[model samples]
Target: MSLPLAIISYLILGESDTWFTTLGTYLYFILLPVFWVGYTVGKKILGIRIVNLDETDVSFWTMIKRQLIANIFYILTLGIGVIVSAFMVGIREDKRAIHDFIAGTYVTFHPPWQK
Candidate 1:
């Protein structure tokens, strides 16, 4: 995502560290997911979607908490939290990662109509 903008910026301006890259990052991580009802490009490709625990539509602030706020803790742990989240998803009955718990959401293969 950011790679394309970074490459273009490098070609055009001889620099990759610019607002274009940042915009790409935000578009990929934040806006796209919120607008798509928690399905990012990869998730959509994989036929997965995120839904709130109560089976409601995911709001922008909820996605922010899930994607951004919970990620801060993972970064704080220097990737250990990410490992834990992977393990939790693999081992837990609900198959939810740390971010899902934090945001009161979960990933599901069920289509929206079923929910």
Candidate 2:
């Protein structure tokens, strides 16, 4: 999604649109899952779902808190926080991003064979 948005923005608005497009793309991922469902449009389509760390239901308020810490906070540090979060996800054995940890949540995939 970020790739596609960045591509379109580059084609239409030149290189300067790259940052805006990138941020917008990330914001979209944050918004949909927190407000609409427990997954972004892409995640929903791919059978990926987000859940509480304890395998319990997560309320809307918790999701909002999660997004604030995970994504929105990036703006406070000029994206350094976001970079760090990505790095944490890459290095951590559990693959949980900083936002996941902050929100106390987990992302999982639903297997077709199981469901």
TM-score of each: 0.84, 0.61
Taking the tens digit of each residue's C-alpha lDDT, what string does model 2 give over 14-85?
Answer: 873578787787677666676644677777788877777765545676676687656667788799988888
Off by over 4 Å in 1: 17-19
Q: On a 0 to 100 scale, what is the lDDT of residue 12 in model 1?
A: 88
lDDT of 1 by residue, 3-111 (tens): 8889998998899999878767765776776778768878889999888999777888888888788889899999999999999989999899999988999988877
Model 1 scores a C-alpha lDDT of 0.85
Q: Which residue pairs of candidate 2 clash?
A: none
lDDT of 2 at 114: 36
RMSD of each: 1.9, 4.7
